[model samples]
Target: MASMNDHPGERAAADPVKLIGVRETPLSVDEVFRAVGDDAAGGTVLFVGTVRDHDGGSSVDRLGYSCHPSAEAELRRVAEKVAANHPVRALAAVHRVGDLEIGDLAVVVAVSCPHRAEAFAACRALIDDLKREVPIWKHQTFSDGTEEWVGAC
Candidate 1:
């Protein structure tokens, strides 16, 4: 199988976790989950975020994600921070951008550690930090002809 492309602005130095990232195509949880698998890891956690049919009870027609040029850099920073706090064997995260239909996967993150709890915690932190800090915006169109854009200007 062909290798995944490197994340934009990712450093050359080797890291325990691979930083495969920010793209406009569909995301694959299986691909990312596999990247984090290691013989030494006793546990692995994967989190997948998908486009939902509704937002705050409003029916959604479609949604799209737009990422700033610096978004990948921010993702790497967040991932590194999470890695620093845990004994991660390997980790990988990918966030999809562009138009998406309901139920389409939006993001996938995986973390493998020596134990279950740490993997879970680190995976959670990695995702949370990425969402909070990354410069990615979500634009949604509702069935009622209204639209909303979330995240920074």
Candidate 2:
């Protein structure tokens, strides 16, 4: 198998940030980490948000996500902000939509910087901004047959 170090876009995909749209398929944490993995980067930070079995004491059985077309545009804007604010060598943010079972990955954000402090700061900011700004909604179904539509909750 090809390692993440040998990612196809290593040479040409040199943009400081990358954003992707994928089906409700599984994501590779290692791949996101490696996308920003560079010798010049001293630190890499990543955030993975997973679908949980419960939310606010409600037992969640499954979730469905839908996004506005503007989601992709917003994600790119977030990545751009990170690159501008920090000495980010590379960054990527990916969010999966459609039906998802418990424990499935909902989103992943990764960032690499010249130092650990900057990487951590940038990663945190990216995730926070995304949760607040991204035009995505989650429809959660509970085990008790109750369902709720939450806007980025």
Candidate 3:
């Protein structure tokens, strides 16, 4: 057990939550992965979501992401909830917004735990909840020049 005199965040550091949001800039998977690296963690799982060239079998020209002002706050809330529910040693998540090209990373998340199963489960929950809970919208431009918006709060 860590003593109180240790790092102020040590005791609670088992669940370090890091939420990095890039509104107009590019998202860094390396940064997100590094944020969740912990010495005590026996396993770490990382998930990187990218923008593909097609969606629903339709050729997609490009895609864009937009977020509400409360997106970051909501992200933190979701991360906190996941950490509280799981034995998370560390957690990190980053989402990219603005115009994006095919093969661009739209989101990256990672979680560390004392065991491999725990790390996989916790990492899954982190990304699943983030995509559902965050007030982020996706704008897609199809090859037919049609556009559609999905998932906005």
Candidate 4:
């Protein structure tokens, strides 16, 4: 029987989550895309999330994102989970915090895998799990003098 430690490269291959962050500045799609580039990957998928003009049929005047101190760690956890479930060769994710106008990039995530379907599935799972599990909240001000905080719980 061969010990796993005999192959250090295989050990590193077990954990493919590369980059994870929460930034106060704007998010960059190109940066995230470049971070996940891999020579061994056959497919790379990138997903950019932007602030929209409206939500729930109401005009959004502006919005701000806030997060707990552990948000970055939580994001890493989500990315790791996605990598573990897929054949992820590389992965990167970043979310912006601060006031943002409509059409501003809010989040960027990318994944590279051995196949197109694997890349797509991993990228989708990364973003979806980050949104659902991260301790980030969005405060939206509506045009009609109303405001709401989302994902606060």
Best by lDDT: 4
- Residue-by-residue lDDT tens digits, candidate 4, 26-101: 8888888888878778889999999998999999999999999999999998888888888788999999998998
lDDT of 1 by residue, 17-113 (tens): 6856999888887789789877777888999999999998999998999999998888988888888788787889899989999999999999988
Scored by Cα lDDT, where does model 1 land?
Answer: 0.84
Deviation from native of the Cα of residue 66 in model 3, angstroms: 0.3
Positional deviation of 9 in candidate 4, in angstroms? 13
In model 1, the worst 10-residue window by lDDT is: 5-14
Alpha carbon lDDT of each predicted model: 0.84, 0.82, 0.85, 0.88
List RMSD in Å for every model shown. Answer: 8.4, 7.6, 3.9, 3.6
TM-score ranking from best to worst? 4, 3, 1, 2
Using TM-score as the measure, name the better of candidate 1 and candidate 4.
Answer: 4
Quote each prediction's TM-score: 0.88, 0.85, 0.89, 0.90
Clashes of each: 0, 0, 0, 0
Residues forming the 10-long window of minimal summed lDDT in candidate 3: 6-15
lDDT of 3 by residue, 1-153 (tens): 667665532334544796556467778878888898888778889999999999898999989999989988888898899888877888988888899999999999898877799889999998899989999999999999999898954
> What TM-score does model 3 achieve against the real structure?
0.89
Q: Clashing pairs in model 1?
A: none
RMSD of 1: 8.4
Candidate 4, number of clashes: 0
